[model samples]
Target: MVRAKSIDHGIPGRGSFMPMRDSIPRRADRDTLRRELGQNFLQDDRAVRNLVTHVEGDGRNVLEIGPGKGAITEELVRSFDTVTVVEMDPHWAAHVRRKFEGERVTVFQGDFLDFRIPRDIDTVVGNVPFGITTQILRSLLESTNWQSAALIVQWEVARKRAGRSGGSLLTTSWAPWYEFAVHDRVRASSFRPMPRVDGGVLTIRRRPQPLLPESASRAFQNFAEAVFTGPGRGLAEILRRHIPKRTYRSLADRHGIPDGGLPKDLTLTQWIALFQASQPGYAPGATGTRIPGQGGGAGGRDYDSEPNRAAVPGGRRYGPTRGGDPCAPRAQVRQTKGRQGARGSSYGRRTGR
Candidate 1:
């Protein structure tokens, strides 16, 4: 549970104090506030300064979330002409109001996601709550109201959000429209009552045009989902299940692909090529061989070795090989000896052994 500190108005350089009638309860009063709200405040002065520096807004309208203890709020007030803060904790909101007082800061005691962004706000900045960070980001991304945003979030989440190609499906889906990059990492020890995990700051810039067409985007998402279903299965097997068998064969034929199938190490481009070739009436040149159980020519010869040998009918010798090598001579001799032994002494007496 997060509790907001009491507002102290008389302090010099501190902003005006405004108390919320329904502010978040004090930690001492109720421990549940922090637990439920995920309010881990940013207490490091250097980190606060770095976050402000990364935002780099002067006289611009800024929207901030979770301004715990006024640490980040103070900086925002100093740098931006109009800094609007939405803090769930009433005490913290009061502290921010008193600290910034007559300066350019407006403290709103409410949930950030529910709060509306002021019109014409160009920049959004906050040390966002970890639990709702994804939702908040999605809201911001979906809204065209802000020009850009700088956010401080959990290091792992930030890494996934900003990572290339290897990021989560959500990140990949959104990548075409927004560019996310990490600015720096803030140590866990830097925060007061330090959090268990470290933090990172990231900047996001929205793009004007998406990378893929709307139709292709859906297909790509479906493709990604199918490929990542199981860890050990080959890519070809997965694709074959999702795509039509005839379609698969046709694509293999058009692209000159081997009957076997695509290899596990096939690149993204190659996968895309295979998908493209599957489209009606497309063919590619054959370049690679396919393994059995995936796709290959008839005869089913072992690609890497001689055909497996099997036992011959009514005899101990094995079947003949294609190379004309009969069963080993030792095998024939062993068979003859076994037959003689079966005839036993009776035959030996009759034949005058």
Candidate 2:
């Protein structure tokens, strides 16, 4: 069991408040919430404390994605001067409003994806519902107001987002500006309604000095998406035929990338160096080359094609284009039928959002 610790911030007449240990709704209400939201409430005080610690809120304004019953929200109010929670469930939003009524808490009942984040908000923290984890994450990562965020999500999702073992295209696309870390994994038993999978505390902090400028962010994203979805046997092999063969060989030799290495297998620094090397003017004679036997696509695939029409090597496929808000919407919403992070659900799993 994790131990819950109290924090004192020397604010007169202002402090945090937790609903009575028994104040949560009865089992019947819990069941209804579960059905409606497709999520289990995080009830462990210790886990809440752990999440707060991971957030590193040092008096900055915070926007919490979901505050179901205010377990984590209570801690935020104590640590930060402003705590605004975006809750999808009206019942729980009303409950949290009444609980933190007079304090710095502002509860808004709405989909976090559609809700406009405040200008002064500097940090985001929450134990977000698993059902909409992908959507919420996209919204947060795309928004530029927040400098850091701590999120509690499904274990595998956390691991992938943090780029454990290998990186995803989404992680690679954003790695130029943000840093991801997996703090700890809480067991499924930690929540009031145990999830089939454990939960992980993940944090994302923007770098003080980003490697790539914001002006180049879109180019970098398009480059990453192209590379990940480009055709060839492996990353090195793909590069060999995609770029000028001499330049590709030089990069491989300089970076020590083996001929059979995959895109996901490359390190963050290597990916940066590679992207730098692939720029139009960075290296001369960098027009793309075609392999004799390979199918035609060295950045030739249209990003706006129909679903599942464009397939890449290694069982990877390019997703369809999202029309508006490049930051908020994914390149593609993989599964339209089920909630993301649901049991056996693959919604947004392909994009690794």
Candidate 3:
């Protein structure tokens, strides 16, 4: 059994990342506080109540991320059969452990991305940090053993994930297996140290049937990324480099895609059809040839081409690493308090497909 350490109120600012020792000493210094800004603690009572309600634990096992000060954790213990919290800050972890020492709460102190998901975890919930919201969502979507998740993330992120403005590359990639939705909007003032932007309660549930076959996961993901981020005037031009423009244009017309429209303009079902038709052995006149490194296409960038492909700014490469794709397991948490406002502010804006 893990022993809870005594609380050290001397430390001024809340602990953020991995401290020097397991028993982290609290210091309210400006520099220390700034480093830990990514681990903002949720303080609003109303927001806490709303988050718990959205979770709908109902006797299920819940895994809460960054349970700072135990605002939500307090309610989780009452609703969940077992509540496991993964906190990166040692101080906060200790505090949670001590607070719920006799309850069905397990506090693990470390980076959540690196933490293992137990076989019994049925539900996941958290008010994710602005800097690592994308990474966290990707992790949750990819991980198994969790039936559903209710997360508090940046409002713009919630919008993109739910395909409000236009489908994002990441959202499009995952649409085959997971369904995402925006449940409620949480104001910026709901947090203790108010964030510049508002928050949203986003819920993600796995689909009973995936749109694409499991074998096509890799090809589908890469294809979606290239189409969204690849250089081109529109979908036609993007595919023209790999297939004949006439063929692509005909397919686009058949799918009701407007001329000169970008990839985001198409719906999820349309993308699936396009990807299926673009495979290497596609039909003679109607279907277009596939691009190398894409679905069922000829050889291109091998899995081991790069140990860890660098992450594209505002974009992420998720799923299991082929070789040691450095960007596969995004470990670094960004500080979102600088000139850019939030570190991943780019993801919030409309993606220029």
Candidate 4:
């Protein structure tokens, strides 16, 4: 069983959404919060299928945060046994209830942050507001339940969380306990009201074997925070302040750290090693095994997976092709350049999104 570990932490859609418009939402807002909370809702079928496809863990129940307009809910009910959706907007909450009255979905009208996640909830999904993404992530990580997640967040956040470009303090700290992956990039145009930055499908799954015990998570996070915020020119100086030069050299050589690798440079593997070494008696866990496809310290980012497959609700072909399950494979078509027709959406089955 995966051990539950909590850490202090975004957001996709805002908890309190704005009043609906005659048409799509606009820049005009009675309350400044309307825009701040993330009003852009997923409108593209490909993105919807991709987001649902990346969901991890095995469970009949799913807790959906901010089911705006029931775009995701429509497809979720078809596959999952039970779908519990939490929406901050009363209008949308009521709408979702009426929309899926017969479906196996429970609608809760309140802030997801305030709602208590059941201990048995194994998975959660959402298209969160980029502003509060970090805060929401903290809540999920701290929850006593929930094993996997599929979220639509800012592109940069998704990239950093997956360590596709490099590693970050967030990924470094959580990497030991969870596996993050980037399924695909959601273009801003895919949403009804386009957002400034494009969205990315980010998936998170609890590691089957944690590098450290649940009891050590708090201390380990603190150590990681220290190294990240500590004053030092490079990782060498910062890490040297905590461990002996001998141990530092050993780790550096093992991980092949360059002369002046910084704290952010360390991958999940290096972070685990450093944390374990800091303990009174250094020892290795049975499952420090590296994740496949993630060359070096980078995350396993799956931007492309399979040649192409049908991904649409029912048997109807929505985009490009249609036949098999909508969430079966990652396939979306898009031109890469200055002015493309529409944004491409794809999903992949891997450790990262």
Which of candidates 1 and 4 is the stronger one according to lDDT? 4
The parts of candidate 3 lying over 4 Å away from their true place are 1-26, 29-37, 56-58, 242-246, 283-353
Q: Is candidate 3 or candidate 4 better by TM-score?
A: 3
Each candidate: how many clashes? 28, 0, 8, 17
Question: Better model by lDDT, 3 or 4?
Answer: 3
Tell me the spans in candidate 1 whose CA falls farther than 4 Å from its real position.
1-19, 22-27, 56-59, 213-353
- In lDDT terms, how accurate is model 2? 0.64
In angstroms, how far off is 267's CA in candidate 3?
0.7
Write one digit per residue (lDDT tens) for candidate 1, span 73-161. 77876677677777766666767767776676766665554444555577888988777777667545534456578899888888767
* Residue 328 C-alpha lDDT in model 2: 26
- Summarize candidate 2's per-residue lDDT along 1-353 as a digit string, tens digits: 11222111121221122222225677798778667676677888899898888775457689888788888888888898788787665557667777886787766555565455565677888887777677667656665656789999888888988988588776777776788998799888998778888999989998665555554455556667667777888886677544667766776775576778778887765666566566666643233222223332122112223333321111111222244221122223333323421111232345545
- Reference-based lDDT, residue 293, model 1: 36
lDDT of each model, Cα atoms only? 0.56, 0.64, 0.64, 0.63
lDDT digits (tens) for residues 134-165 of candidate 3: 77775565565566788999998898789888
Q: Could you tell me which residue pairs clash in candidate 3?
A: 11-26, 11-27, 12-27, 12-28, 13-28, 307-324, 308-325, 308-326
The TM-score, computed over Cα atoms with residue i paired to residue i, of candidate 2 is 0.73
Give the worst 10-residue stretch by lDDT in candidate 2: 310-319
Full-model lDDT, candidate 3: 0.64
The true-versus-predicted C-alpha distance at residue 179 of model 4, in Å, is 0.2
The residue-level lDDT of candidate 3 at 194 comes to 79
lDDT of 3 at 20: 23
Worst lDDT run of 10 residues, candidate 4, spans 340-349
